[model samples]
Target: MAKRRTTPKELPDAVREAVDRTVQATRGSAVQTRERAQGAVDDLVDTVDDLVKGAEGRIVRGRRAAARAIDDVRPATNEDMRELKAELRRIGRRLEAIEERLPAKRPPTTRQGAKSGSGSAKPRAARSGSSAKPRSAKRGSSAG
Candidate 1:
C-alpha cells in the first residue's frame, strides 16, 4: 500500500483556501447580524412613535377637560360680559336722549350770613362749646 504525500505548493494553496472560506462565512454572519440589529432598531422606533402619539392624545384630552372644568366653575362667560356692557351703553344713551328732551332747572342759592327760616337747632357739641373735633374733620383725617 502506497501513501500519497502533499507537495509544498499544495500546502500553501490549501491554507489559503481555508482562510478564504472562513472569511466568507464570517462576512455572511456579520451581514445577518447587522440586518437583525437594524430590524430591532426599526421596531423600537415604531414603538416609541406610538407611545408619543398616545401621550400627546392624553395630554390634549386632559387640557380640554381642564378647560371644561374651569368653564363650569367660572361665574360668567366672555359673551355675557360683552352683552352686559352693551346693555349698559344702550341705557346710558337712552338716559342722555331723555335728558336732552327735558327742561333744565336752576339750582337754589343761599345768601351768605343770612339766616334761613329752616331748622335752627344747633349741635350739642357746638352749644356746649366743647373743644372736640367735628365728625367731618375726624372722618377726613382718618381717611387720608
Candidate 2:
C-alpha cells in the first residue's frame, strides 16, 4: 500500500489530538498485554512446581508404605521360631497332664453266656426271656 503524505501543520488540531490519543491507547494496551502474559507464565511455572512436589511426596509415601509391607511379611528370626516351638511344647505338656487325670473309658459289656473261648469281639443279643439279664437291667437306665 502507498503511504498517504500529509503535513502535521495542515491537519486540524482536533484530528491531531484524536490520532495522538489513539496512539497512546494502543501503546498502553500493548504494555498491559505483555504484563498479563508474563503473569500467566509465572503462574503456570508455580503450578508445575507444586505438581512436581506433590508427586515427589506421593513417591516417598509409596516407598515407606512398601517398606512397611515388607516388614510385616518378613520371616521370623531363629530366636522367634524357637520361642514359638517352646510355647507349643509347654501347651502340649499341660494338655497331656489334664488328660492323664481323667478316668479311663470302660469297654462295652456282652451277654453273660457269651463264649470266652470263641475269641470273637462282637456282642450277642439275649433272648426275650432268657436266664441272661435284660439289657436295661445290665446297663443303667433307658431313655424311654
Candidate 3:
C-alpha cells in the first residue's frame, strides 16, 4: 500500500484558503511588531534626551558651586584689584587738591634779623633771669 502525495496544482480549495489566511495573519502580526518596536525606540530616545538634559543641568550647577567656593578662598579677583587701584587714585587726587588749597609752610622767624651775629644775642636763661628750673626738669628730678 503506497501513500499518495498531493501536488500544489491539485490542492483542495479549503487548504488553499487556509494557507492564504495564515499568510495574511503573519503579515498583520509582523506589521504590529514593527509598529511596537518603533514606538519603543521613540520612547527610549525621549528618555535618553531627558537624562542628558538633567546631566547638563547638574554639571552647570556643579561648575557654579565650584566657582563660588574658589572665590571664597581667593584673596581678591582682578575686578576687585582694579576697583582698589581706582579708589587709591581717587584718594591721591583728592589729597593733591587739598594740598593745593592749603597755605604754604614757612620757616619760623625771630624779632631780630636772621643775619644778626650770634655774639650779640644773649642766652635765653640770662634774658629771662628767673633761676627756677623748668617744670619738666623738676618732674624728672622728683621721679628719679
- Top model number, TM-score: 3
Give the true-structure RMSD of model 3: 17.8
Better of 2 and 3 by lDDT: 3
Candidate 2 positional error at 98, Å: 27
lDDT string, candidate 3, 35-142, tens digits: 999999999999999999999999999999999999899898799999999999799678768877999867545766666565546666668887977645755777
> Which candidate achieves the best lDDT against the true structure?
1
For each candidate in turn, the TM-score is 0.51, 0.42, 0.52
* RMSD of model 2 against the true structure: 15.6
lDDT of 1 by residue, 13-99 (tens): 899999999999999999999999999999999999999999999999999999999989989879989999999979967876887
Candidate 2, 2-45: lDDT as tens digits: 99987677569879899999999999999999999999999999
The residue-level lDDT of candidate 1 at 83 comes to: 99
Computed on alpha carbons, the lDDT of every model, listed in order, comes to 0.86, 0.83, 0.84
Ranking by TM-score: 3, 1, 2
Candidate 2 structure lDDT: 0.83
- Clashing pairs in model 3? none
